[model samples]
Target: MKGKNIRLLRYAVQYWFLLFCIYIGYRFYLFVRHFETGGVSPFVSRPPSVEGFLPIAGFMSFKYFVLTGIIEPIHPAALFLFMAAVAVSLFFKKGFCGWICPVGTVSQSLWMAGERITGRNFRLPRWVDIPLRAVKYLAMGFFLVMIGLIIRTSMMVLFFITDYYKIVDVRTMKFFTEMSTATAVFLVVVGLMSIFYKNVWCRYLCPYGALLELVSKLSPARIRRNKKACINCGSCSKHCPALIDVQHSESVSSAECFGCLTCVSYCKGEGALQMTVKIPKKGIRSVRPVFYVVALLIVFYSFVFVAKVTNHWASGVSYQEYMKLLSKQGPTQREHPRLP
Candidate 1:
């Protein structure tokens, strides 16, 4: 397939996933509204996909599951979704961010628009860029250490049952809907920076992206350059959203290579740059852009499929529990819980 077609398909996929996420979010809002409105509004099903936003909860559940061989029932989907993301990075080189993450899609759209409006996105100098990139890693390390030390293995399942943890998703939802002035300002600044620089939040601030990027470094599939077929037009490097120098590099070893294949799509020669997997005996088998995207979908959904079949996808939060918890968080209740 032509690179142009691949890129076009990529846009379609990105927008479609973004829309789906919006749908999930809207449904979740309605679900919460039923409790808030004292059943005056119609009830909507609480979407399990909303658990995707609860990554901190997901990370904790995942650690608990790994150590105890028991899945916390409160937010089982969080662990599964988190596992799926890590699994995607493990096999497909952070394609989750490139293909599925709504944040990445929004970031890409902002930067692309900025490029068209400003004639080009500005690249930070090496010294500045390198240190900024380290910010995400440092943040990731800090959380990993803190969460590790604070939540011991013995306290894992117990922590999940706490009222604070049970209501965390609600807390997260309120965090966005009821953002403080500082958070609002910070987001605005990040959005403007994303306009001027490529993926400013993902590149410099998102610890989740940092974790995925680190895991993607181990992916067997990678974009390799065939220098002999290169025309040296530097199109690959110029178009790279991650700012990777694809023209000079033999293989994309950078953690920033997120399997977008923007480099491959822009390359002049068919074989000049390719995302390929090294075979056991056979030579490295090149992956088509179409196949790469399809494989990503398959890998992701396969995890979802297994989770569903094994009853790991839904939250164990019963309707009564949600009503009890969310009502206390609703308009009627104050900070203190009312006695029945």
Candidate 2:
């Protein structure tokens, strides 16, 4: 019953975030349509939060900031959103991925749906899984290395100021709304895979997840088991979405541990498993789920609040400016305005 309540609380939070993403998508669609229809459609203000989709842009923005000490003005929100996600992972173990990411929510829902429809979701064999799991990390590394090379070439500044960079968000929208045959097939394959295998994209292809997992490796927080309190029921291991062997493991500090607290919530013994953070001189103290949730929310929003106060939350390019850049864009626009 307690575990069910815990799962329910997580579901409420997940769906709330998913709904918010849907709302953002709708508003952004209207915002794009206002430009696409040449002032015929009702205008809507672009939501800065939509920039959350632009993590690569955020990555470039971070690199630009580190190199030139200036935030990329065109997608200022991208930098802040990326920072918030990294902060969440640093302190709360990929809470952004496990709790706030729309993609993650969809992945979870797809697997849940599969379980409901097919009676179970399947895990890959360990021999096949380990190498596949490294794919995300390899992808992340490749991106970072490419970015580092770009920075060395000093083309980063030129890339950022390009008209192409300014309107990439619109291109992103079109990628979904106007998928090519290849793109459609690719998505369908991925969707089907997600139904059969839990977190197919998340576990194998998400460079962002790999990045978060890397940062979370430094987090002092982990799932800890108390031998005395444990009933040796193996329920925690069975319930762990990440497939961590929480039943026998004294510490679950793996990169796979995204701190979802499933093991703790599903533990049959009352005090067997806990989410704990090691403190300076205070030892490891158990953290309540409510407290963890509160801290995660506060940490994430605090970054946004800072960005807001500093006038870094919104793009410097106004709606009218966007109108000008997107003036020639039509329903099936293919060419993005190149470096200008």
Candidate 3:
């Protein structure tokens, strides 16, 4: 019991550091927008629609300029940072999901609440799990083949660079801070769905998660099993939030494995499962909790630092300016402008 308490304490401390890093990243973004443009306003904003060259990239206020072709604008820093994120996941597993994802936190909290309400835990069968996992991959392929490969490489390059892509200016953040009814409804449904399923959005739907999974399968850093230990208690499988059967397999069975080390903490068998450079009987000597925390911080801050550096050289002007310029020139072209 004392040992378990100690382990839990370590976990809490690690999470504290990771959370602090996330706070830093969030604050840094706000600070830049506030200072540079008078307040935390969107550099570009518009209704969620695909009619423009800068269609919604994600839930974030930013967009990938590489998606459009204007001045050959590409955020190399973000590209490298995202690449590094995938590379790190290869060794550390999906530390991003377990540690830093705000959505993951909400899902886990919901699962805990459900467990408290009903003594029975929710566990999906392997048949359901296998097919559900494929959805993320399909979504990823759609974006890659359709938007990334075909559109960016072909017609979008020509179509996106014109004035029709213009949408909104720096004032867009104010629009969101004061949410309309439709945005409120969307948020409510997302929140409810998150509570009902443990990372349902991330596990089965997120295209980014699918990309991470592909890279994570090749990660050298992993939890290995010792067949000789022989107890096969199956405790690790039960505790795995990803629902992976860690006990039976030499390697983690699913890409959903987030390297949270819950299995490592719960395992009673000596040297049964451990982290390793080369699947050691007992893995690395460093503090496991510290490693988890550091990895999470690295992922969060790397994204922020790149955003900050880019803002310096970025046109960073809003779409509203272009729209106004276009309106003055002639007719009010309802057609969204491409990246100028």
TM-score of predicted structure 3:
0.64
Clashing pairs in 2: none
Models ranked on TM-score: 1, 2, 3
Writing each residue's lDDT as its tens digit, candidate 1 over 15-83 gives 998999999999888888877765557778778888889887888888888787988888888888888
For each candidate in turn, the TM-score is 0.94, 0.93, 0.64
Model 2, 191: alpha-carbon shift in Å? 1.2
Point out where model 3 deviates above 4 Å.
1-81, 153-197, 279-287, 299-315, 318-340
Model 2: lDDT of residue 58: 90
lDDT of 1 at 130: 91
**In candidate 3, where is summed lDDT lowest over 10 consecutive residues?**
46-55
- Candidate scoring better on lDDT of 1 and 2: 1
Residue 198 displacement in candidate 1 (angstroms): 0.3
Which number leads on TM-score?
Answer: 1
All candidates' lDDT scores? 0.86, 0.84, 0.56
